[model samples]
Target chain A: MIHLLKQQWWKYTAVIILLYVLIGGMLVPLGPSALSLYPVSIPSDTSVNFTITGYHTHFEDAKDLQVWFKPTTGTQFYKADSIVPIINSTVRIVFHMPKSNLANKHSENYDLVVNDSIDGTLTTVYAMTVAAGTGESSPAVTPANQPEVNQLKFKAFAFPFQKILFQTIRNTFFHVPMWFAMMFLLIFSLVYSILYLRTGKIEYDILASQAVATALLFGVLGLATGMMWATYTWGQPWPNDPKLNGAAIGVIIYLAYIVLRGSLSDEIQKAKISAVYNVFAIVIFTLFIFVIPRLKTVDSLHPGNGGNPAFGKYDMDNHLRMFFYPAVIGWALLGFWIMSVRVRIKLLQHKKSLL
Target chain B: MRKLLCFIIVIFTVLYTSAQSAEPIPSLMESNLKIYVVVGVLTIIFSGIIIFLLSMDRRLKKLEEGH
Candidate 1:
């Protein structure tokens, strides 16, 4: 065991460090409630009373609360002078919406930000849409001069800080990287498979098999992180979205590749047949992940479908792109490192077998 | 060998078909299904690769020993 550890120490060490970065370092800093959005909806031209509830787990102590509201498309947030001090574990703030502001056609929605001083928790500014009322009459009080149409810059909070440290956004880092790594490894596996078929060499077969094995590892990690992200974002452990279904089908095809490899007894024949099948599997997997998800008929809650924007103006930003792109490269490199080690091990064993 | 291959195919096909047929999911159910399938597929693929690698190692050992 020590000999084995020493021989593969670098690979093992790199994997351990990566795991630590994934779970202990990155995930812990990213809080559990990091990606949550509060829902708020109020009717226009009416006064409504609403309470803000904050659940406390770590610090049960009460804290000073400040609520901020700004127009969704504007910069200036109306800060409430009244600070609600929490008596019990839960803090509730009641606020009334002005009827006149609701009547103005200038604003359609408001962004709400709730802050706790003691715990230092800043809730994502929840956006509330204004519903039309029966009385469509203009506001009773009209300002003498309305600002120029273009100059009426309603400054709102600068776009929320680009990214959070939690596992909630782990999909962008972990899951996406896994898919990229898998794709990279699969490309090599396909090449090796084709070479094995052409040359009838066991070496190419071993390389192809090792590459698949490495790709599978990345695929699994991607899936696990995706599940975690979905649970927090979509409020469920699993969703039958088209993008998700395509992912499942893609994995199944690769798994079928493995099962095919296992069933063959003759080494030479197994290598030949599995190689052909793997090539087909890669094609099918690509179609499932890319082509199937793009079809407009398929209803999916994933971004980039069903009227949802792709990772365009909404999904990702510069900050996320910074860490995310590096993550892809790092993960792919790690996958290649593992594949090389496995291929070496296979070659050693094959040499011993021939002896 | 052929029989084992056929059996594995049969099991995988059954699973794939079952997953496909279980659809028309409600909004909440749809979200949950997406998570489950994505994670499930990935888990299967990863574990399957590890198992295949270990089996290959064993086969190499057997061949080495002239078994």
Candidate 2:
């Protein structure tokens, strides 16, 4: 087995690395999360005031602040140039929805674009539907009582899914896979930890340590992707949402695992203590990430509970599944592959030291 | 060996069955490319590690037996 491994190591490693670069790096970011339209209802025929709110970020201080609005269905665009200087990182521009526009038989679609001219940042693009007949002065009953409104009623629905997808490309690429990879690694670590505790084998301890290290790498990546995803999807880098909170807690527990490993000096003692802690981390991670969030009543941006369906149903269509499953398997297998290599390297280093 | 072969067979069967399902095949261009890249990178890295480990394991075992 050793001879075979030694002779063919380079070939196997090269093949694995090449396959990953080809599939994971290049193939997954090609989906449509670019443009979306949301419909908001207004009292029929009444001219409603529309307000466009821009979040204050570092670029908000830029000099050229331009807000543009155009009816998605109509040629006319209402422009408010050089609006009030953004204060406290937020600028709200109000415009009157023309009553005449609402008087038509169908609901009108309005697209709002906020641009920071100084930084050349196109802050946000959103479409709102002004429900027909909701405007002041209800029009006389026509063929259809009112036209369809394309504006989003709920603020959640107003989110620019497409733009978020583009901006947080690495979020999907790095964050989610990290979590999946982390889970697989952690589980492997936990199993080895258990075996070490039962059989008192130094080899199992080594496996446990390597698994924890691999899992931690995944955890960090998951956190980075999640933070970016939160920024684009929720319009903030971090929100106090339940799901976000849960993920934070879970990561902290894993960090504690690393700390525990570092605190002990004796190799045998370190292994045993760390093994115990790893088991605890697994339990806590499962509870915090999986159980607690599901039980909590607080609203979450994550899908499955709290009025949001997970990306699994809407985002994970047939095409996505094809690459997504492969991505998961490929990543998990790769994680194991790395862990094994690290173990071997450590074992060799130990032997060399003895020599 | 039998267990390894069985595992491979099971995986192949699962893949085959999943492929036969009614869902339409998704276009590569239409899917999220970002996810694909991340997964791909992770796979390569992990696979490389596994190969290296296997090699080391063999060498270590031989050294131990010689002793």
How do the residues A4-41 of candidate 1 rate in per-residue lDDT, one tens digit apiece?
A: 42366556655665565444324223221223223377
TM-score of 2: 0.54
Q: lDDT tens digits, residues A194-264, model 2?
A: 99999898878888887777676666656655664554456676887776777778878878877887888
The segments of candidate 1 whose C-alpha lies over 4 angstroms from its true place after superposition are A1-167, A305-307, B1-67
- lDDT against the true structure, each candidate: 0.61, 0.57
CAPRI level of candidate 1: incorrect
Off by over 4 Å in 2: A1-163, A166-171, A305-307, A352-355, B1-67
Sliding window of 10 residues with minimal summed lDDT for model 2 chain A: A152-161
